[model samples]
Target: MDKNRMELNGFKWPDGDVHCRKVVFSSVIDMEPALRLTDGRAVAVQAGGNCGVWPAWLAERFERVFTFEPDQTNFDCLVQNVPENVTAYRAALGSKRGRVGMCLDTRNIGAHFIDGKGSIPVKTIDSLKLKACDYLCLDVEGYEMPALIGSVQTINEHRPVIQIEDKGLSERYGYQRGEAIDWLKMLGYRVRHRVARDVILSCAPA
Candidate 1:
């Protein structure tokens, strides 16, 4: 087996030689936020775990990690890569509870969402019955808005620091740019930083 291709097995962009790829495969997209976190549980949505790198990152720092991924193909590998402290769930998260269609991008396993191909059940974060969390990471393509809607109670109650990918709005998945920020601000969260393709929000005093 080709080692390079093996590296690309679960990667979002697996096309060219590893050295030649435009974007490098990051075990965790951003590190500063996680590095600054001192303690508490973390919740990671859109677990298209591409080697479970991000989840593993969370597990290493937080007391416990709860991650969700609806794609079976990605879930299979995700299950194998997470640490014992990380709980991996094979489900989609949205504003409401129900099943929705998932569009899978074969070229990039990490891009799967509830817009195309197959149908998957979605659950609300409020239903998780979580008592508290310190960090929240969302990368569910364009479905971040609905998922955040479902997590309103959690956000207000737990006040976890939030990070979300915001590149899919123009692609027509679900949300628009700055939409999540507006919702988060309404919940007493402020923009911590806007870097690259992610917007980091924190529940700090205004």
Candidate 2:
């Protein structure tokens, strides 16, 4: 165990955020908007399942939760920790289907990002062909734009409430600041709330 990493519920967590049951961001900012909009019947797609905390949280409020984690170590933790109803994918979600590498972090497991040259597999959200997706949450470091791009079909069809982490770190993925929100706006989705680094978005009603 690293001095800065702590183990809980059989999962390795960043020491600073190892509070009771949260890996990082709480459900209030990450999962609540969707629950409120869909009345807890939202079928959710989420990414960066650091230690399964978010997915477990979603499962409690949403009808079904599908989570993606690209980090093998974190994925291992996620699988063992998430509720049985929460489907966990060990691959990262992106704009295309393929494999990429991750930029590992020593301190924060959630800080790992796709650096475009690793063995980790990448799958598009569209690839899932989900029948219903009323909510989507993405925290994939700087790759939220690509993930959103990959989810265009679902977004267009279901008009799900979306919550994405927008910490201005997209430069690592060659995107301008606020690029994801800008692109979403182009599709008529507007920001509904901004909590810490997360931005909640929903389609404007017709």
Kindly report which residue stretches of model 2 are placed more than 4 angstroms away from their true locations once superposed.
1-30, 204-206
How does residue 166 of candidate 2 score in lDDT?
89
Superposed Cα deviation of residue 100, candidate 1 (Å): 1.5
lDDT of 1 by residue, 31-73 (tens): 4564464245444443444446677777777777888878766
lDDT of prediction 2: 0.80
Q: Score residue 11 of candidate 2 by CA lDDT.
A: 59
Query: How do all models score by TM-score?
Result: 0.81, 0.87
**Candidate 1, superposed: residue stretches over 4 Å from native:** 1-29, 34-48, 116-118, 168-174
How high is the lDDT of residue 124 in model 1?
83
